[model samples]
Target: MKHYIYLFTLVCIMMSCKKPYNPPVTTTNYNYLVIEGLINTGQDSTIYKLSRTVPIGSAIANSPESGATVTIENDKSNVYALKEIRKGIYAAGLNLDTTHKYRLRVKTTDGKEYLSDFVQAKDSPTIDSVQYEYTGNAENIYSYTHDPKNNTRYYRWEYQETYLYYSPVPSYYIFKNNSIVPTNADDETQVCYISDTSSTILLNSTAKLVQDVIYKNPITVVPITLDKLKVRYSILVKQYALTADAYNYYQNLKKDTENLGSIFDAQPSAAATNIHCISNPGVPVLGYIAAGSVSQERIFIDRSDFYAASVGVDYSYCGGAVITYKATQRTPYPDIITIGTDIPTDSLVAAPILGSKDSLFTIQYATAACVDCTLKGSNKKPAFWK
Candidate 1:
């Protein structure tokens, strides 16, 4: 009887036990800013991105101060004030020139302050020349090569362009292998690069004869008297940024490049345009035409406008790359030759035509000759033959 009573008492004690304490859940907030753009107005402009630094432990985004003020300036008198484009993107009117040093300062909408050390922009190097040649397995494409004879000089390019055409759809056709291709042919603008190596060396050379020879007998096109292209070159400035900062800067520049897709971005088309006239007095011949048997006087017409820009910094400097600009032609260039020079006098004498803005193209150091830089001599190599 006593044992039974003890068991019943133990059961009551077990049922009366309590659970552990629990705490209330809490939440935090954090925010971060991302900047992705470039200063390519051809003049001076500074792009400054702003955002609140996000915290690691917070799930909520921080509310950035809306009335923030940012400023960028160079050692010279040039100064630019940042204007808010979006919630976190701030822009300034400071023009971009590589000859000066720049510093960035920010004042948040709530009066918070941020600053960046002085960043020096590098001067533009001379371009030897801008030249192109046939490339690829079938030699169906043309490319640019750079050839600054002086090893100490460097260069980059940016194009201002306009695509001129007229139609209900603003498109046109270019002949390829005896076939007509309909493309957007719309007026637009953007920045592009020379991604091939062979094209790079060719781009840097200043030899006009080399360019003439290549254009006379293009790798892809039918080498006829009418097959000519107009090409021009200009001096461009090279900039420097730290290695870690380059990737971020490139992404931003690309974003701005994507915005140049408007119909009004190119020049207006005229019913009558100037073609090469035979034997004009007082005018120097720019190019030669390839006829059935004999070469004649004809101006070369560039179907695509090209540009190149270089970017680098002093500390642990990295080489630059090339960018190209064109309308709606998306053909690949397998083998390219680029010829360029930094000398202002040797550069082509043309400015960005108003109402006819060509897209910008950039070329930096990364555009080197191919590991196997072989020219297709009469062997009819697949890469050099059409």
Candidate 2:
């Protein structure tokens, strides 16, 4: 009887210690407006990207909020209208007074209105230098800047990177008129340029420091194994001044979106936005707008900057195969070198035969992605490229 009692007690303890607890399924059926971008007070054109945020289970994050009337309003009642250059993207050139405060006014296609809080245009200090440090397996790019007035304490950064790329096997020929032909010297698919924009949220604050100085604030890191470091690389860094409120909002957003999924991490929370829906005050908006003048700087890094051991000689899976010319009793001198029709699909590289003599003998072939730089990037160099 005592054994039975002990067994029952143990069973009860085991039942109470269930491993998984599933909360009830909650659905957010309403889409919320998400406004992004800064109002540039300088000579540069100002652009705002508007979109709608979907549910947590949504496969797509950005549902563009189209057909919206966007405007910039100042304290003196001066209004500047922005035209929709593209779907969900509104742009305008504004030369507003630096002393006056500015705010954004937006009216959605659904007839709902929204407004951003009035903010003073903060001036971004010039970036003193953008330097890099080599660490274990990666290179960290850092930015240095300071505000002489010590008033601009908060900062934000965005960057665009362009890199030169080369095809593993240079394509010197083109298939035309049912024959292999040599391409123009300049038309060879040997080199190209590719560019990418920064998507991560980068922010810094010097509010607690004695002087408004940001020294060696790391912006981004490039792993040594990344293809971006395979050749000449250039980065254009744009810095923005932000208010304390804007800084905190971005910080919260970074934590909510980028810092999740860790076991010890806190649960994701809603990020606060300055823009609000006037029609339905209870509806959540998903962005913060700050008025500021941006400062930009560009730097280039060559392959020589990389450590010898870190350089990647084989960035792509590139190899060549030879397809021999075959003549049979049934078919005399069949065209086995013609890509997409005669050559085995696996052996066709879209490029012409590796050499003119190969057309008479066995044809040397490769993959287009491995031999054609145009498949990855443009052969025309960017105007800013040096």
TM-score of each: 0.28, 0.80
lDDT of 1 by residue, 98-140 (tens): 5566665555444345444454443323222333443321112
Q: Which ten residues in a row have the lowest lDDT in candidate 1?
A: 287-296
lDDT of 2 by residue, 80-113 (tens): 9999999999998887778989999999989899
Worst 10 residues of 2 by lDDT: 340-349
The alpha-carbon deviation from the true structure for residue 211 of candidate 2, after best TM-score superposition, in angstroms, is 0.9
Q: Candidate 1 at residue 112, lDDT?
A: 41
Candidate number achieving the greatest lDDT relative to the actual structure: 2
